[model samples]
Target: MKFNIKNRVTLLVSVWMMSFTMNMLEGVCSIPSSLEVFEHHKNVTGKKWAVLVAGSNGYENYRHQADVCHAYQILKRGGLEDDNIIVFMYDDIAHHPKNPRPGIIINEPNGSNVYDGVPKDYTGEATNAQNFYAVISGNRSALSGGSGKVVDSGPNDTIFIYYSDHGSTGLVSMPEGDDIMANDFMDVLMEKHATNSYKKMVIYLEACESGSMFEGILPNNINIYATTASKASEDSWAFYCPDYGLPPPPEYTTCLGDLYSISWLEDSDKNDMTKETLQQQYQIVRRRTLIGYKDFHSHVMKYGDDKLKNDLLANYIGANPSLDENAYSFEPSTTQTRLVNQRDAHLLHLRLELQMAPEGSKEKLKARQELVDEISHREHVDNTFHLIWDLLRDKNNNSTMMLNVRPPGKPLVDDWDCFRTLIKTYENHCGRLSSYGKKYTRVFANMCNAGIYVEQLKATTSQVSIPLTSSSTQTLDLSSIGSSFPTSATLQELELVTSIDEELLQEYGDELHRFGKVQRVFVVSLKDRSSHMLAMTTSFLKGDYQDELRFFRVHKSDVYESQVAVTKGIGKYDVANGYAEIKVVDKVGFSTKGGKVTNSKFLLFHIYLS
Candidate 1:
């Protein structure tokens, strides 16, 4: 099944005409001077290089990849060679099973096939933060896959970077993996500056809360200029939406372009690239992306060197060597100008699928379930965070939690360490905080605004527990007993205490019966993002003070404070495969596995230590 649509011929023709018009507008005398200036720049600035990245995958996110391909097309037409332009996209949408057009991708409602010649320098899982940095820093040794083509640029080169993806405050999601944190990304830029990788750089990003990447952290003197689709607190929008009158192909059910993305690209397509200054282009994109739609929009923002706005678009995007006066031009009708929130596009498509599906059919049922799950997942995440908030408020009787912080959204402070600790604590106790957990980030911001410490929040949430016996109990003070019992005490001491109170020992293995006070618990998840392995401090036994348990893949420098003991008979049961057992032996370094055993590993366990 494929959508039968012609690649817009005018797209190429307009490029030629626009370039011609720009040259014409510049006048004959201006052309020689402009060439002289560019030639001088070429001598000083080695080459122009671009890194185009679309940080998402799947059929539903067609627009992101399409936007990147379109950007590549513009840069290519502008004169940058393929080797100078590095592209990072999942490269899955064009031929996706669900794609209406098997080998084609369009940016606008009735646009050209932008995907035809886009480079696949890096694709799939390789399009991650690690690879992105490896490419930017020209460290081929750090690259994981693809052709391993890096920028290979020097201080004399000019760099342009464009990234389109799903983003939240301080983080951007990478497909099927962890996110790219703003601080880490800034570190990469600082590294580039420190190494003199380029003379000047330009960055354009399209994502929900894209501005957060540069709003406060990006330094202005770093020779980098940036623009984002929206402010840190808002969602970027999609254009040519479901209600755009022209129905999408039968196999597709969503918008064709991102609002801010298409606004700038289309402006480039229509106007003269040579004549268009970056400032003029920004004004055009800002106006159309925001006010023209009158439906859904976001505040497009710019950061870094404001003077760079006067530079020619050709300096970054490139310009054609010659133009054609007889080229074709295009202007979309009002019917094609609808918009929707980019973050909600997939969910909206699923709902539309269910709405349009035949009643009680398999397709209808499948769509219904997907829609329900999507909504339910979001609600579940919100409910979980709200539960944590309520529990903490109730436990501490802190009326400050009742503060009205909702009407006007609050900005997240640059306190990355605070937010990271708080998020880790929640995940350590609750579960893996996935994409849905991102919506709760603002709650952490609110907590920070309320002057709450991360430890205090951790303590409040740690109070939640499941009843283990007929009598409910609060946190236990085992440090007092630890004072009398030395780490070198006989094995009989361990047996004597457990034997004396077997019930209490069995009730809480991870927390309650502590011989010496537990200092910290470190949780490690597999690199494949699967099951979690836990390590906890058992006693202050000097060299061999801690105990290690279970299995999860560890990274190169993943250091846990505890000792390492590879549990034997580990493969006998796999948790993800539905069979697992966990036990805490009276003696250290003892391992037992086989049958499914229920313990703290499978339950929500808490730990509080002095």
Candidate 2:
């Protein structure tokens, strides 16, 4: 088909050019495009599973349950099915008597009700550490009293877990039972990884010291990513509290949401999941939580697989195509200006209850008593720790050892067993270590780090005798022994011979002789032993000017040989107010015949004031 003169040469060139073009087209078709390779690796068949937990109960802890419910709503809207999501909450907030809106719970001021449609798989007593562990491990047999829903996923599935609660140095609190310890939690995650239960996992934890759950413990190679509301040494703040500028309705008293929780949640609510990466959301949340608040703030921390931060949020949560493009907006100024410390939120709730109760009514009295008890309980916890520290320091001669904090990048304790055993030893002697007491767990960790022995702690704990007031003291029937006694007595006139025991003299000789010669004062009564001897004693010693004006009262009881209940100034003796223990050091030269004393005995009184 070419022209004549150079026809043969032209035809040969045309044929070669056509062959080259055909070979190029064939090569292009043989190799796959970048978009096709990306689609292949996306593995579109993978399913998403989620677990939402609220690890606290009571109206004062309304924010936890509310946070969980809001998270459920987000997952539901993200196209995750109800069957794939498991919810564990105490489920007491929505219908609680203190709830202003009887059937509704909101995460923020003027926010939509998140309480609706939240599954009650684990509620009431079922919301505990055991059940939570079982759920994560997919061990249905280990769970008790719940709907038995667990995160039963395969290797190709993506898992998301969100927990909101009160946390301490190395554990997160549970509603009905033991707390979720950090070591145990990490063990569960490792077991899950070993079993190939999921391809990737993402965790969002909201609690005081939430970062302790994973910091320095979670391995980056485990294919798991976690973001915490606060670092191991800080407190997470609560938002929309009663006194805050962005408070909820006037009828509401408790906080509406936690600061870090609401930041990520509201960000998710407004942003397009497909267009956002987890790292982007974490940055947004961290900024919002740290800024716009002058009084309180917490560091939003991330741990584990840093590479996972690059993945799209839609891979785990999913996206809503119905939302407009402009929905991807965030405003730090819109965030609440006032925030409350998570631990003190309950105090605010109690104070509100006391303030709102009707004046002079039984409700008001009950509220007032409850407030008083709460304050007293906190004082008791503080005092107990202080006493424990004092005793430990006396032995070790280290004043600041118990309160020392480990530097960053180091674990809470080198030996987890020692830390746990010390806590058990303290609890065994002192009583239940309540949520308020959990803050002292770092002290236990420090002791473990310092190589403190459990036996030493036990011995120190035994020596710490908590002061017992009338309400905490046990009742004793002293009616039979009080009939044979004088109505009034003075320490100077009532000269009774007594000898100090050699052991007590050796231990407390200086303290005992500091007041002068040991003098005996006794008073007995059948009725009202604590108050009857109020007017009996006028002075402690006759000659010693330092002890002359000091007043004292002896509370006689059949339970012991002799006990003194002394007051400092001249006032009515109220046993309910205070008392001192008088230990019997020795009993010498006493002879009893036919239930009557035949000979005088030298009785020693060891005075120990608390």
Go through the candidates in order and give each one's C-alpha lDDT: 0.63, 0.72
Q: What are the root-mean-square deviations of the candidates from the true structure over C-alphas?
A: 17.1, 14.1
lDDT of 1: 0.63
| Model 2 lDDT per residue over 394-492, tens place | 778876656676777778888888887898898777665776778888889888877689999886665553223222222323333232223344432
Q: What TM-score do all the candidates reach, one by one?
A: 0.66, 0.73
Top candidate on TM-score is 2
Candidate 1 structure quality by residue, lDDT tens digits, 1-610: 0121122234334445555667787783222434444444455548899999888887778888988998998889877899999999999998887677889998766677889888888888787888888898899999898878888888778899998877776677777455777777888889999999888888999988788777777777988888899988778887666655344554567677787887787767766676677788888778766776555668888888776776677778787554434322323345435567776788767766776777669987687657655654554456455656775666566655532333323335547777667766766665555544564665665566566687777654554312122222222222222222223323322221211111111112112233333333333333564333443322322235343223211111222111222221112212211111122111111111353221222111222121
> Pairing residues by index, what is the TM-score of model 1?
0.66
- How far out, in Å, is residue 39 in model 1? 6.5
After superposition, candidate 2 runs with Cα above 4 Å error = 1-45, 322-336, 465-610
List the candidate 1 regions with Cα displacement exceeding 4 Å: 1-44, 245-251, 321-338, 356-360, 393-411, 428-436, 448-610
CA lDDT for candidate 2:
0.72
